[model samples]
Target: LIQTVKLRLFLLLLHWFHPYLLTTSSNSFPSFPLARERMKSQYVTNICLLILCLGAANNTPWPLLIFLASLLPLLHHTCRVPGGSAWRGVPAAPGPAGWPLLGCIPFMGPLAHRRLAELAASHGASRLMALTVGATRVVISSHPDTAREILCGSAFADRPPKEAARLLMFERAIGFSPSGEYWRHLRRVATGNLFCPRRIAAQEGLRQRVAGDMVRRVGYEMERKGSVELRGVLERGSLESMVGSLFGESSLGREREEELVGMVKEGYDLIGTFNWEDYFPMGGLLDFHGVGRRCKTLAEKVRSLVGEVIAERRRGGLHSHVGLGEDFLTALLTLPKEESLCDSDIVAVLWEMIFRGTDVVAILLEWIMARMALHPGVQAKAQQELSACLGGAQRAVRDSDIPKLPYLQAVVKEVLRLHPPGPLLSWARLAVRDVHVGKSLVPAGTTAMVNMWAITHDGSVWADPWAFRPERFLE
Candidate 1:
């Protein structure tokens, strides 16, 4: 009995001092009851030693204690996988070295876009960039071929996560949702109703009306103030157009419009800020930095407004045609029951549609105007085209005339290429399975972001990528 006790204590000491013993050779240890019993005894011994160590080290500094605690799990992980194929090193692309635990979090400061741009320029667009943000490993591809491969392939169809989707869409709307049956249905309905050629043609009249109002508003401001704030005017005009189209009439007065605009702006600003919870996962519980709280408040406000609009539409009758030929809301409500449409679903879809439609149009208009202002030559060319097409008509540019104006179309395309509304088309992925892009193996649950901004700016893909000359598309 004394010999057995001694043997057990010796085994315990070995287990505590060198845990890698078992992992070194799977075949070394016999699969017998005696070996199993010895293992259990060793574990107990190790636990006792751990307790004793903690008691003895009670006077250790708090930071040291925390550091040791953090290292304990890592030590166990490395030891348990000794000589295991799982621990084999894989070839990875080069990236900046980061500190332990925090890993590149400090590098990605408030100006992530500017910082990333600088990194791309310095590192070269063909190189793969990796950054460990909290526990997540983010790999950035600056190659247009890689970006195109990821975006166009079926391997990357699932959206990232709820937190990311919420930030991008400003609501738990279906647009940024995971690629599922619900998302498919939502996309089908939206494409059929809002993005189809026929629907776009119908919406053309609305766009022309809004654009005319915008031009008039800009002229009035320029005449009164001698110069117009282009961004502000475009923002309001775009918001009005979206609200009018979605509701078939403007429910938002000046105050409401301003409020909605502010909310949308806040949404955009919040999305750009790095939320601790987004990277740290459990960090959300503490509501660290109060970002989660702010997001919840904004979401609630938007939801309430959307709920009100949906209620009004339902009460007014599903197919109410009070001019404007029954807007999007009317079409949604009028869909057959067999189509599985619900009031909440309609509100969600409309919420996503309004924000996306308004924001993209506003940004695109601003970019186009800025580009035109920067290049007087391009501006003159556009003005000449406008004159030739409309004969100096003081009205909005019509959609019917867009096809006839090749230069204008080229300008739009160039702007889209240079400054896509979404720099990264929200991350997408296919269901858990191995996917290959060239030699790289994209494992299951891998998040894929099509870095459209990086792709468009790649020197390899475009000659003199920094130049904003729209003539590149003229051919």
Candidate 2:
């Protein structure tokens, strides 16, 4: 009898609010007798539910639980505070009215990029589309202008990392670190130390060795197995190349190199896997795939390994910096007191370089190889350009030689256009403040993402976007 009375009261409130008071202000709606009963019923319902839950734990009948479960949507709507910003005023950028807790997560399958684009187009929000994934508001930029605005806007300058990234210590690194004094200092130090022309020239020998080693490995794989699987070879070589650049070539022993390669692969996998915690509140507790657990283990390993390296350099244990090309480690070690990073920060910065760089370099190269096979004519032209640049001489390619091969450069550019390594710009950018992306106002605390894949593939953006045309870039 009591349960039936509660059910009738719940239905009555739902019926009242169905059209009459959903949009009305508190001045009129709260004064209603049903509204007063709602407030009182809320507390009574909580106590009743708790007692019923304890009974259910003792194998209570399923009927009551089923009935209560059926009323969840009503409960969720009733519990929401009135006059939410998402509903009031101009209204949040129009999108789907997702389910109670899951939001639009259940709708966006594996092809979330395509799905988001479709959703945007369907809602006539082709430029900036808004949606929620597990109650987290996310605005996606589907057009080039909108994407550019979000990318360049100061309000969206903060690159809030996904849950996996944070658990894996990405927040401390340059790539995902919040915009601030530390990030600026970190960027300056890294750029000055590692990316300068002088440093590039200095690392020529390291690049040559890594390339030659990769070619030899490919040949060996072919000879032994009659074919080569380049994924493992490329992944390992790319990681080692990044490590060599950071720690000075050959600073890490062979065993350590292999260990670090394994760890980078772990990071790459974790970063690629979608974690529920990134979207949903309290989602961290649901580690169904052990993503968080693995990320923690990886973080500890990276810190320990990178810390070991920094310690060795400090103790003068490595093959001396005697002939070294002054890697990032050396520059960081010699940083002025004002710019000096803590040991943990140093490890994060170094690990981040390798972790982010390897997979991207490897993947880009893989796409180039695929494109080369698909377009033999383009490959032939690229080869001819290379041959001309080398002037019939047997030698390795140099950074300076790049200017002499415009066609080859175009080939690389076109490949990037067609197959960008980071389809969503690697990760989503966060709105530090309410920002207007085109005409849409992305509220503060919302996540913003650029759909680079959509932009790159759009018919309006490129003439025959599906066609692989290197010559278009050359023009």
Each prediction's TM-score against the native? 0.76, 0.81
At residue 215, candidate 2 shows an lDDT of: 93
For residues 1-475, write the lDDT of model 2, one tens digit per residue.
Answer: 9678656755664554354223433465443222432343344345445645675577666566545543654554543422122323434665654444655665555566766666666666668766667757777787889888888889987876587888777468887788898888888988888888888888888888999899999999999999888888888889878888898877899999889888878887887786788876778888788999999888998888889889989999434563448777887887789788889889888888888888889888888899999999999999998998899898889878988999988988898988877777364799999877766777778888888877888888899998999999866
Worst-scoring 10-residue span by lDDT in model 2: 79-88
Task: Give per-residue lDDT, candidate 1, residue 71.
Answer: 57
Q: List, in order, the clash count of every candidate structure.
A: 2, 0
lDDT of 1 by residue, 1-475 (tens): 9558545654554555554322323355643322332253344345545744583457545345334533543444342311121212533334433333444466556544445545545444344454455555455566766666666777677665546347445443675666767788877777766667776666776777777888889899989999998888888888888877777756556776787888778877776667767666686775655666787788778778777877876676764453335677776776667766776677667767766677778889999988998999998998888889998787667777887788888888888888876775344344245566545555555555555677687787889877887789885
RMSD per model, one decimal? 11.8, 8.9
> lDDT of each prediction vs. the true structure?
0.63, 0.75
| Best-performing candidate as measured by lDDT | 2
Model 1 per-residue lDDT at 339: 67
* CA lDDT, candidate 2, residue 43: 40
Residue 189 of model 2 has an lDDT of: 87
